[model samples]
Target: MAGAQMVNSHPNVKKYLGFALLPQGGVSIGLLTIVAVQMTQLYPIIAAVIMLSVLVYETMGPVFAKYSLTKSDELYGLDKLNESMFEEDTEN
Candidate 1:
């Protein structure tokens, strides 16, 4: 997820993703250890599948966040036409 954080445009996205990844550090150690223990029994293709799935999942986060922010920006601007309706009159 370090790769995703590096390219994410939003600060919240990077910060949250960083926090989410912290626990994975320990989890990964255990997972890799298990995988290593069974290395001789595993097929080579399984390793490739694991790497590809992780890359795809990591890549989708930033892309989804980018589009989500873009959609939010659009929604935020939707009420601009009514902004003047609430303005106080300053005419003498």
Candidate 2:
């Protein structure tokens, strides 16, 4: 359960929200590229939507998970120097 929890994330990190949305966008674009090149009349609207989703994803996904534990530990007082919890709050 602890592993599932998100802790010690930085302001520079995407906070998972941005990163999660990005994958959907990437998949949409990829599908759209394949379909658009085919130029079939199956569903142009669907392809367009996919491409649009990709644009949104790339703009947001890479923003998160930017900071690592090493960087946080080095600069910030992460995990109390020897604490395993990666604690940020003094009373958490």
Candidate 3:
């Protein structure tokens, strides 16, 4: 969020601020792996927590990204595409 705030000064840039808030599980998981290897005592609990966090973030990240794009009006034709996917084919 701090990254977002830093770029929030510009009107156009503000719309893309959500991109900065997107979760990056790869980096977190990599660092967690290193920490777990270095400190074996806290490995189990810390690993569990980090895995859970990554799972939650991975699931919700797309939703947040889509919401941000929607709010910024940057989805283009994606909404239409999504809607079309759910529509039944009358000719079938």
* TM-score against native, each model: 0.33, 0.36, 0.60
- Alpha-carbon shift of residue 60 in model 3 (angstroms): 1.6
Score residue 72 of candidate 1 by CA lDDT.
41
- Clash pairs, candidate 3, are none
Highest-TM-score candidate: 3
Q: Model 3's lDDT to the true fold? A: 0.73
Q: lDDT tens digits, residues 58-84, model 1?
A: 666556555544544533444664565
Cα lDDT tens digits, model 3, 2-66, are 55567665453376656535667898799997987798999888999999988988888888777
Better of 2 and 3 by TM-score: 3
List, residue by residue over 4-43, the lDDT tens digit for candidate 2: 2466445434233343334456456667677767877865
Off by over 4 Å in 2: 1-26, 33-39, 65-92
TM-score of 3: 0.60
Report residue 50 deviation for candidate 2 (angstroms): 0.9
What value does the lDDT take at residue 60 in candidate 1?
68
Stretches off by above 4 angstroms in model 3 are: 8-20, 77-92
Assess candidate 1 and give its lDDT. 0.52
Best by lDDT: 3
Error of 3 at 50 (Å): 0.7
Q: Each prediction's Cα lDDT score? A: 0.52, 0.52, 0.73
